[model samples]
Target: FSLYRSYFGKTSLEYHLQTLENNLTNLVKRNSELENQMAKLIQICQQVEVNTAMHEAKLVEECDELVEIIRQRKQVIAVKIKESKVMKLRKLAQQIANCRQCLERSSALITQAEQSLKENDHARFLQTARNVAERVAMATASSQVLIPDVNLNEAFDNFALDFSREKKILEGLDYLTAPNPPSIREELCTASHDTITVHWTSEDEFSVTSYELQYTIYTGQTNFISLYNSADSWMIVPNIKQNHYTVHGLQSGTRYIFFVKAINQAGSRNSEPARLKTNSQPFKLDPKTAHKKLRLSNDCLTMEKDESSLKKSHTPERFSGTGSYGAAGNVFIDSGCHYWEVLLGASTWYAIGVAYKSAPKNEWSGKNSSSWVFSRCNNNFMVRHDGKEMLVEASLQLRRLGVLLDYDNNSLSFYDAMSSQHIHTFEISFLLPVVPTFMIWNKSVMILSGLPVPDFVEGTSLDHQEQQQQQMGLCRQESPYLTGMKNCH
Candidate 1:
């Protein structure tokens, strides 16, 4: 029994030892794997450290290169600034040198100006000093005339002439001599007329005894006649008649040249010759073939034989409006009717006769409707109902049946062949003023001295007879001289 037990115990001890050996081998294997992993981790750490160091060194090298470039650029900028400063200093020095040279030139010019002023020649000195001062002012920006003021005044005093004294001397020289010839002025009435008026002013020292007038007429044929006359000292020629001596028997259609010579006791002066052509007379109406109402008088006045005879005469009904007229003897006056009514049933055209007269000195000739001669004086205006007006002068003699007013200022003026005066003023504003005997025609109202149409009639239609009647009524009511009558022609 003791021997068997000892054997079992020995086996058990061997198994335990085997198990311990297996566990020790597993530990050794695990520790070897741990060491290999640690070695790989260490190698990775070293590579990371080396790479970090290389990157840091590269960054440092790049920073040093950038710093070096910045230093070089800063050095180049500083050098450029120093060069600009040097150039500015040089320019300032050159400008200073130019100013010094200008000052020297100006000083020399001033010296020359002073030398010119020392001489007595004032004009030359003024010219030289002006030039020098202008140049100096331009060069040095200064204004200084080098001449002394006292010296310039003295030079002017020495050279200036006494103008007032010289004028007195001239006046004294003319005191003893004979006065100048009398001044004469001559003027013609018109270009184609024979009348001549002269005006003269005699010198205070001389007296004129007699005056003479001379003239010549050309007859187109080689024949020429010269006429002369002597008269007492007078301002106007006395008894000056037309076509008497100056243009005696002159042909109607011929042009003539005439001259006037004025003579005094001292001497005579011929005036400039004037050239003129006489107007030929119009064709005359024969007495045998003339109309029935027209009768020729010895004094060239055509008289109407009978007013009632004309009313029954059966002449062709011709339309006569403003300014149209018949033969000389027939004269018509408006009876203050409207122009349209007078022109009713009539064509566009018509005619009438006009007779005008100035203020008559003789007894009023009660031949026409009324004998109150209306005068258009220089300052006064003659107004008509048919919008016509006229201006008159002294002694305007209008002949019966001599003037014809057709329209507006269109009128036949009877310029007296003997007197050369415009004898009549006619109005043709609306209708012609002519004899109503031969035919029923339009006639114009003779506007006597009164207010203008615009002043009295205020309407669009100026020729309205109603407006004219209203105006005439008002005028008659206001004026004492204007007699309201239906027969005022």
Candidate 2:
């Protein structure tokens, strides 16, 4: 039993020593953690001290600036008051001198009159009295003329130091903060073919000293933040004083993103971006490229087949052939998207399309490799490219034809303007600049350019797969009358 007690005591002592060692380790770990926390707290205190000093210095500097401004204004006002006092004193001294001179003249005149009264002899007295009376009359008139006019306005009533508004402003002075961002007035903005007038409004306009306008072409970029961060693509117009600005020489038929910044000495804030788009470029039919047998009227926008050939100088660009009666537009399109409409007024036979600048002018458009056209010969409608004609479904009574040329996207689409129906689209890989081409065998056709793309047209457009399907369907069967127009043209 004694031996058992000794062994148990020894085990208890060992357990106590292990527990003590664990407690010591825990205490050391806790103490180390407290020391680390204290060091961090010390660092925070030092940072706080430095920040407090920096803010204090900034406060003193701002106060000194305010004081200096007040001192300068006070000095200016004091100088002005001194100048006013000097002017008043000088005028008052001049008036006093004039009064003294007038008084002395009156006294002299009175003395002369008294001497005249002293004369006793009748004739001498009469002569002396007459002379004295004349002298007195002259002296009175002279004194009236020499008297200085006293103006009540010279009391400095008009010169006022009304600094009540300024005092209120000074009292309201505080730390200035960045102005609130401007809001783009999208509805108020206007755009032309080559210019965009951006209008904006600011909530804190009084605090803003100037405005900055930043803009860039919007090329289907959904992430505006990334687009704006690209500094090289942006165009900035700084120090704009007015709420509106007009930017000229912009690309026609293009979309742009704009931001206005309200800036001041305190700081600046940018407005939310606004998207604006310019209209399609305005173009007229080129009379210079018209066939000699064709008649152009209505500012060269309407073309008609003329039986009598008109007198015109023939150039290499003019359409000159037996059956190739065609005309090209005035402008060449190489970039951007454009939309124009052709008014087919009582025209049964017509071809509307685009052609390369180097396209043969003396040949029927769409019969060569350089042009693509949507043509209607009598009741048959077809799209022809590179001498290959494909039949397409179109309304027989279609009056207006819409053409959309997306040069960058390499697309040429035709639409039924009245019904907003998609007629056809050509996916061409254009390697050269192209111009609008028109050919008519009967009646007249008019063009309307510089029009915005219609909403229905945008929504009704087919996707890539659908477009490919439609293209394949249109090309599935070649037109049997392809050789028929060979003799007609």
Candidate 3:
């Protein structure tokens, strides 16, 4: 029994030892698998690190390339800026050269003009001398031909007196019966496609019984329709009423020529013709004169009733004289001495003369002869003259004349009227004062004080000697210089 028990115990011990061995082997295999898996993870981590390093290096290289590209672009922009600056400098230099050339040409023209004037003066002097010699020779011949018994001195005196009387009569006849019409005074008026206003005055002494207004319309074709002959078209305005007349109900975009004739018991004196361009829109007056009544006619002769209602409402702005403390009182006191004159001419007309009082406090003390003329006012431009009060043809009263810078190129010229010499040219850059009240008059010389003259004439004059020297230098560089004298021996 003892031997069998011991053998069973030994078998059980052997079985337990085998079970422990098997469990150890399984634990070892599991540990080996875990070690392999850790090794694989480590390898993957190393590969990832290598890849990250490569990517970082590549990114750095690309960043360096981008920086270089940016630097190159900046340099290119800088170069373009410099090139643009150089181009502008070149253009400025060209402009300077052109101005210099123009100045030289003008100088040459002035020289030529001066020479021509000198020649004309010399010719006139020679003609005067010849006429004086002829008169002396004729007088001497008449004395020599006289006989003793004929009372030669008396006869000669009588003949001379008769000749003088005949000459005076001929001159008078020429003055009275001149074929040419008197100068017409033109006033600009607002005229549109639908309506027009005509204003005129006559300087002649003839009694005007009626005024005949004539107009011609162009139909855009070869034929022009004359309104003068048409009975319905003629307007026989009595001279007892106002001088101004308005014509309305005309086609748009049409050009019309207008004229006036004064008819009386003796005869009819025809006035010079003027032109007006019509617009489709209604006529409008300048805001300054909007309150003034403007005439309108439904037919050329028949007046319209509702013309005043169509005008836009406007209030006159109060005139504020220069801020001088006593200016307002001075203007009022000198108002009587100031006189306004309107000149009408073909193609342009304006109010010209403003004579002021000499004394500020005296009723008629200040007398300053300052002229304020405007060719354009409101929308109306001076087209032609009829008599007095310029004939204006426009859509509205331009009132441009009252504007500071409203200067007519021809009207503002500073010329010696008696000598017909050009003294200066002025570009109007300031508003013109109203006639009569605005001028600071000096009666002694009949000139206005502080009136703006031409810019070139103000202050110091151009130093022609220095300018010529500078011009010579520039001309030599820019253009071929020619010697003034020829060297032919």
Candidate 4:
């Protein structure tokens, strides 16, 4: 009995010690994890603090400038008031001198009337009295009221041929001398690669007769070719009466800066030049799901419409009938975000978007819920989904366009590639990966963009890699990530 009790007690003691050791190991692991998380939280809080400081500084600067402008304007108004008061006082002193002469003239007329009465000539006496009254009338020179011989007809001589008493024509024509330039209100590139639209606010501050648009494309070297033939060097779009202008004939995938000048009677005013970059993207057409009338190039990156005959693509996934000229893109996405541009070369009608694998063929690309598209029917623009249509106004010359897809957020958007105008966006509940889609109408050609997409992910895009290489110094002896690992060890 004594041997058994000793054995049981020793066994129980060993088990308790082993359990305590295991508990200690778990607690250490948990502590390490908590420390790492705390460090990450501290870093995030520091970043937020820095960002807040930057924004606060910017707001403070703008507020100070606004307050200074108010102060200057107030000073100017006070100076003008002082000058006006001096002028009024001088005029009042001159009027007092005139009033003395009027009193002397009145006394002379009254004395003449009394002399005529003494001579017994009543008619002469009455005439002298009438003269005295006329001298004292409100119409006398010493009276407060002063009138200028200004004619309404004369004022409206060049403004209008016919003038009436009730209807006074203002100075209709703007002054020939150039006025200040119109300030830019908004500007953007269009769907067409070579076109850009600019809008400026009409300068109510200055009378603007017209405007001229000047633009320059960045041509690598210092040499630049003007759009218009002008020796002065700047190409000009003259006599733009409206506040908005759409500039045509620009190169695709190029950078351009536009300048607008408002002209009036005195001089011309120029706005601060605006700079923009055209959209760029590279994509290929998938021939496996291409429709009959759509012919894919050997490179499979471009598609053209051929109504003469059908190409022999036997894929069951292909479009048919109403959608007999559709092609899917080689790239498909299920996660992350991407942007791509397409050049629609003189195409009358076309559609661009992303479509699910099981999208219906009987309906147009945008008419099905599985597909979301920005489509053009002749000159009209429409965003269609699930047979519903939302019409939007875009120029008839839309050529280059862009698509932005966010798979994780389930959002798709389209824009004019040249001007960067937001055309449309669709919220999607993606059940499957969606492929880029192209639709052709009549005899249109869809040119896939050759520019690379903006790389947002770590390894998905070339631009992202280049950015990483620049930031991380890929050739450095010790990378920041490596140094971090070493520190952790």
- Worst lDDT window (10 residues) for model 3? 332-341
Better of 3 and 4 by TM-score: 4
Give per-residue CA lDDT, model 2, range 271-344, as digits (tens).
99998988888899998899998999969899999979767788999998766677889999888778999999
Q: Model 2: runs farther than 4 Å from truth? A: 1-56, 68-164, 311-316, 462-465, 476-489
Q: Worst lDDT window (10 residues) for model 1?
A: 447-456
TM-score of each: 0.22, 0.69, 0.22, 0.36
Q: What tens digits encode model 4's per-residue C-alpha lDDT throughout 82-168?
A: 786676666665656666655566566667656656865678768866766665464456334333232233322243323353234
Q: Pick the candidate with the highest TM-score.
A: 2
Candidate 3 lDDT, 91-204, residue by residue in tens: 666655665665565565556445555565677757755655564455346533221122223222232113477457545531122122322344555554457777767665
Per-residue alpha-carbon lDDT of candidate 1 for residues 249-285, written as tens digits (9 for 90 to 100): 4333234454433344335444444444443222222
Query: Which has the better lDDT: candidate 2, or candidate 4?
Result: 2
Residue 199 local lDDT, model 1: 42
Please, what is the whole-model Cα lDDT of each candidate in the order they appear?
A: 0.37, 0.86, 0.39, 0.64
Rank ordering of all candidates by lDDT, starting from the highest: 2, 4, 3, 1
Off by over 4 Å in 1: 1-26, 52-60, 86-90, 109-124, 136-489
